[model samples]
Target: MNFFYFAYGSNMLALRLQKRCPSAVFVESATAEGYAVNFSKLGRDASGKGALFEKQKSTALGVVFEIAKSDLKSLDKAEGVWFGYDRRTDFEVVTNSGETIETTTYLPPKMDIQLQPFGWYLALVVAGAIENGLPQDYINKLKSTPYQIDENQNRPSRLDALETLKSTGHSNWQDLFTSPRAS
Candidate 1:
């Protein structure tokens, strides 16, 4: 059995998603109604990660990925599903082509935390959004999202991800960084 996973945040990046599910294939660009992306999940990297924020009249833009059932556990582990994000198959997404697909989405069990995403983390998101050619206005909104510099130069994970962006044709996230909150 295969599963449809709607990736709205970092998973929007092909490279990042590839690392998690080698067999994963992009189905299409899709949107979930009445939801918005929220940087409310506290990550092990000491930065905030994206979660779905429910509100009326808001929709989130994302990509649909088809993953093999066998790879679900690995994908779950990569997403901290058993710990941080709670996986739910309750959501539905509509493709730009107007097809509605039932799929899985993740959110924090609790969303009380409000924190800015690390610059590198936010960069991963922006890179994915641009690579997938999500709406320009949505990309602008992503670019405008607030972020922080994870200055602990010793963080290999952060550095490694930034490095991986090169393969995706994105220069260093910080080097090209521009935040509306900054200026």
Candidate 2:
């Protein structure tokens, strides 16, 4: 069996998602009405992570992917579903082609993310957003999103993971990972 998933954040990257679920495959760029992509999840690293929020006038743009149902468990663990998120399958993602897909997504139950995301984390998201050719405006919106430098200097850039996103034509990805935040 296979299932569709709406990947609005880092999972939007083909390389990253494929590593998590070897059977993952991109479906199309899609939109989630009434939601906005934001960094609000309290990550294990003690920094902010990506999640969704309700925004009446805005939609969270992302990609839809089909994955083997057998991979669901690993996906859950990788996304920290039980620790910081709850899995939900009731949402609909409308593809650019006007086709609606039935899929699952993970979101925290409460809006507790009060800090900025780490630059490295945000870079993965921005790169993935660009990889799938999400709307330019949306991509810029992601780039403009405020992110905090990873305070823990000892924490290394997720180089292995980042390689996946950088493969998507972002040779300058190195800068984006630690670019100066808007002052």
Candidate 3:
């Protein structure tokens, strides 16, 4: 069996998601109405990660992926289900073509408003949005989100994500480092 998963953060990048869930396959671009993307989830490295916040009259755009049921455990482990996020399946997202689909997604167990995402993390999100052909306005919004540079220059995860973005031929990948909103 396969399941639909909606990705609104770095996982929206196919390359990034594939590393965690090998069976993930892009389905379509979708929108979760009444939600907003925020970088307020506390990450293991003391940085902020992406999370969805419910906001009336707002919409959060993302990509829907079809992943094999067998890989659910792997996804759970990668998402740190025990502490980082709570997996939920009750969300309904509308695809670009007006089709509504019930999909699973992860939400932070708690939010810290003072946290901000690392530059590399947010870049992965912006790159994914561009790679998936999401709306320009939405992309711009993501790009404009404030981010902080990881002082640990040799962080393995950050290195790997930047390498993937470069290897994948994302033309503006370098710009992400220079153009983020003032931290």
Candidate 4:
């Protein structure tokens, strides 16, 4: 069975997904209605302590992945769905062709504002929004999204780590850097 996984965030990054599902096939870029991606925090990543907000929302813009049924389990585990996302079948519309296709969308489980997104994660999201054909104004808005660095302090409202990586040619350097450490 082939599964159409509607990707609306970091998964939008082709290089990132290729690293996970080596054989994953890329369907045309798509979008979900009544939804837009936003930068927010998830609960699990917060760990009841210092938490940074990740990019999340019900209406987030992402990409679509068509993968073999055999790879579904591995893909799910890679996405951290076991912790916060609930897998569901939904409709994906190809903005360029006006085609609607059946696909699996991940509905995030409710969590606190602590599940902050790291710089690399946010970069992928920004890339996804652009790929999904979101306007420059919207992209700029996403680029300027604000989040709390900690409980008492909010960081600058702009791309941080991801932007840095892009500048340093490290956006697709997963094998090159195991941890978030700078190259």
Count of clashes, each model: 0, 0, 0, 14
Least accurate stretch of 10 residues (summed lDDT) in model 1? 174-183
TM-score to native of every candidate shown:
0.92, 0.88, 0.93, 0.66
Model 1 regions more than 4 Å off: 179-183
Give a tens-digit lDDT track for model 3, residues 88-167: 98789999999999999998878998999998899899889988999877887888788888999899988888887887
In terms of TM-score, which candidate is stronger, 2 or 4?
2
lDDT (Cα atoms) of all candidates against the true structure: 0.84, 0.81, 0.89, 0.55
Compare candidates 1 and 3 on lDDT and give the better one: 3
Candidate 2 per-residue C-alpha lDDT over 1-183 given as tens digits, one digit per residue, 9 for 90 to 100: 999999988889888889889999999999999998789888888777888878899889989999999999989998998888899887788999999878899987766657688777887888888789887777767888888766565664456544665576665555654544434
Ranking according to lDDT, highest score first:
3, 1, 2, 4
RMSD of each: 2.6, 3.3, 2.9, 8.8
Model 3 accuracy (lDDT, Cα): 0.89
Better of 3 and 4 by TM-score: 3
Which residue runs does candidate 2 get wrong by more than 4 Å? 151-157, 166-174, 177-183
Query: What is the overall TM-score of model 4 with all chains considered together?
Result: 0.66
TM-score-wise, the better of 1 and 2 is 1
Ranking by TM-score: 3, 1, 2, 4
Higher-lDDT candidate of 2 and 4: 2
Worst 10 residues of 4 by lDDT: 47-56
Which residue pairs of candidate 3 clash?
none
